[model samples]
Target: MATYNPIRDMERFADALLEGSTRGPRRMPMDLYRDGDNYLLTADMPGMDPGSVDIDIDGQLLTIRAERTLPKAENVKWITRERTPGSFLRQLNLGQGIDTERITANYDNGVLSVTIPVSERAKPRKVQVSTGAPAGVDSSEVVVSEA
Candidate 1:
């Protein structure tokens, strides 16, 4: 015998209400960090079709989209259904100094990894600093260029 709990029903109702507020796309959890000269991003998307994943870059915006579908069965009653299936989306704004042309993404074991390489111009470089005067040259003998 299954007993109906009012608290559980209320919780489900609240969840549905909140979920309905964002009808477009659900947010997927992700982590982003800079590794060497590249920015790495990883998103967790379990039980998703690899082919259903789509990534796009427009200007400074990076968008990731994926779909998760649950099979529907006939003449079956669900005692408790918690996992909602639909579209998942995540957007990030990549500012200047990023090599967008060489951006790469890979999905493995339900984890999506994105590599954003830093531009050559953006990479850290050491600027040579000259000290006092060269070998036999004296500071007073040095002639500054006249524009």
Candidate 2:
């Protein structure tokens, strides 16, 4: 007969419970990058429908929320369940130059991609220099003696 260490087993069980409890809807991971004139955000959302996702930008905060309902089987017994299926919510703080009105989003192959265009004022512009003086200026100089 083999004897198990109850203390170690209790520690592992506690750790697992803490990890699962902290993984509520606010823990979804995402990747963000800047490409030319737009910012791209990619989030992994497998088994979720595009219609169940909601994206909103208020001021400089961007929020992404999604909900998924797992299919129920009448008489199926689950041997193992690993993948997490639940609602997810993620919020990202955007920079001031982001143009919220022009933001666009697309979902494909279980990945969600959001493109936020930069505002015109935030784009770099070249300043034109004027070399010549005023068009109506006279080049001649007038000197008056003490009167």
Best by lDDT: 1
Q: Which candidate number has the best TM-score? A: 1
Question: What would the per-residue lDDT of candidate 2 be over residues 1-147, giving only the tens digit for each residue?
Answer: 445677866876785586576346645668988899998999988888789999988899999999877777788966544455677888988878878999999999989999989999999899988765556766465455798
In order, what is each prediction's RMSD in angstroms? Answer: 4.4, 6.0
lDDT of 1 by residue, 81-111 (tens): 7777899999999999999999999999999
Compared with the true structure, the alpha-carbon lDDT of candidate 2 equals 0.81
The Cα error of candidate 2 at residue 31, in Å, is 1.8
Off by over 4 Å in 1: 1-12, 16-22, 132-147
- What Cα-based lDDT does every candidate model obtain? 0.91, 0.81
